[model samples]
Target: MIESKRRRRTVANIATYFVLAGLSMFCIGPMIWMLLTSLKYEADIVTQTMQYIPRRVTFDNYVAIWTQSGFPRLIGNSITVTFLTVTICVATGTLAAYAFSRFAFRGRTQLMLGYLVVRMFPAVMMIIPLYVVMRGVGLVDSRFGLALAYTSFLLPLFVWMLKGFFDSAPRELESAARIDGSTRLGAMVRIVMPLARNGLVASSVFIAIAAWNEFLFALMLTTGQGSRTWPVGLQLMVGEFQLPWGVLAAGGILSILPVVVLFAIVQRTMVQGLTAGAIKG
Candidate 1:
């Protein structure tokens, strides 16, 4: 019986590893193809036969996108919008989440549920109302306006995710800080926030990624190159008569660098926070 169980466990482990490997390949295959395509010349890419490997590698695509196209401006706009979105979401979401986690008030449950309702609505549904409001307020066609649009959708998500993390933080610590003459906000800043710092990082990264890759709102909100983001700018690269695949691929690669660097810097912290939240919340 023991021997049979051991054999079964080994087989299960092998199957799990195979499944994981296959999924990893599925997710990473497109990225690898894009990177390879970016390195190839236009002639090599637009070939008669399937060319998995590049005949020649060149940095010309990168140079052209950077120097010739408005891609740099788009990248700058994406960065600016992402910064603003993450900053606003984190600042407000943290406080709102802490309130939900600590305080009991009338309609608290209903309010939290309302946030979930906001998230449930399709993003497209909000566009008309947002456009009308933005136009009325003279915020249309601006990066800050785009950032505000992102905040409308992402703030609820940030609050919900962060409330879970805040819930995991011990109330006893805050109470102890209060006894030590710390104000409520001081207790949160000095004690609860430190404890939940990892959770905060995880939530901020999530919001930042959403803001970076968001396209529809960016496309709808901004008309000019001055405010358009990378995704929209890349889409506009496809002309009526021609498709610049190599340039687009190069742009895609360049566009991902900021996110990649962000992940590299915060990988350990984000991982710890996510794992801790999973276990604790």
Candidate 2:
């Protein structure tokens, strides 16, 4: 019986490893392909035969993109827009979430419900109205305008997610801080927010990634490289007359660097926060 059980356990372990290995390949394969493609010569990329591995690897594409393709300016624009959106969402959402979680007021349920409803609609539906508003305010083709546009889409989700994290903390913690003479805002900043840090980081990561990768609004709102994001610039590279595969792949790799570095830095906190909220809430 013991020998039979050992055999079964070994088989199960092997199957699990096989499944995990396949899943890992499915997820990371494209990223590997993009990186490899970026390093290949344009000739290798355009050939009739598939060149899974490049015969020649070079940084010429990377150099060309940075110096010639307006990638640097687009990178700056994307960073500015994404950072501003994340900041606005995190700042306003955390405060709004605190209010929702801590206080009971008139129309509170309705207000929360309204946030949910607004977020449920397709983002494309809001484009026309948002365009009108941006145009009216002379914010068209501006980084701030794009950031604000992104905020409208991300804010509700941020508030709802952070509110759950806020709700998980005990009221007595704040009450105890109140007894010690901290103001409400002071207590939140000092006591409650510290406990909720992981959730905030995780939410910020999601918001930043969403804003960075958004193509439609970036294309519609910003006409020039001065305000256009990497996504929009990257799309333009695949033009009507010809396709620059090597440069496009290089741009893809470059665009992913910021997000990858960010995820690597805060991923542990993000994972813990995500699972912690699920368990606590």
Candidate 3:
């Protein structure tokens, strides 16, 4: 019976691995194709036959997109706005999360629920109100304005995520720190935060990616090349009479590099953060 059960488990594991591999390929297939297409010449892209592999690789498409268009400006704006959004979320969300995790204040439950309520509404519903507020404050068509717009929606998510991580950290340690002459903020900074660093990184990366790829807010908030993000810029590159597949592919590849690099840097931490609560010691 033991041998039979082991054999069945082995077979199930093999099937699971195969399914995971297929799904990974399905998700990553388009990215691989895009990278190959970006490396191809314009002539090789719109071929009579489906050219899976490029006969010749060229950097002309990358050059054309970088030099001919306002893509660089768009990239710069995206970086700036994404940075600002992540900074604001981290700065504010961390404190709010800590408060919710540690305190027994009045209406705490209601306040946390309100944060969820903000996220429950479709983002589209807030566009008009946001536009009016941003315009009134002379912030429309600016990178900072766009970042603020992203924060309006992403902050609640950041707080909720970090709050879960904080909950995992023991309150005993915090109380011990307070007894040792540490203030509430000091206890959090010294005791709770280090334990939850992975969670903070994961939360920041989530909002950063959201801000980086956000198109609707970027479109509605900004007007000129100075503040427009890469998504909007890439969309604008598509002309009525012209479809520069190679250029678009190159732009797509370039746009994802930052996110890929970010994941590579924090991948281990993110994995730990995600699985932190699954197995408690």
The model with the greatest TM-score is 1
RMSD of 3: 3.2
TM-score (C-alpha) between model 2 and the true structure: 0.91
Task: Please tell me which predicted candidate would have the highest lDDT against the true structure.
Answer: 3
- Residue 280 error, candidate 3, Å: 12
Q: Write the residue-wise lDDT of candidate 1 on 72-126 in tens digits.
A: 8999999999999999998899999999999999999999999989888888998
Question: What overall lDDT goes with each candidate model?
Answer: 0.91, 0.90, 0.92
Model 3 pairs in collision: none
Tell me the lDDT of model 3 at 262.
80
Ranking by TM-score: 1, 2, 3
Tens digits of per-residue lDDT, candidate 3, 8-70, equal 999999999999999999999999999999999999999899999898999998999999999
TM-score of each: 0.92, 0.91, 0.91
| Residue 208 lDDT (model 1) | 93
For model 2, the local distance difference test gives 0.90
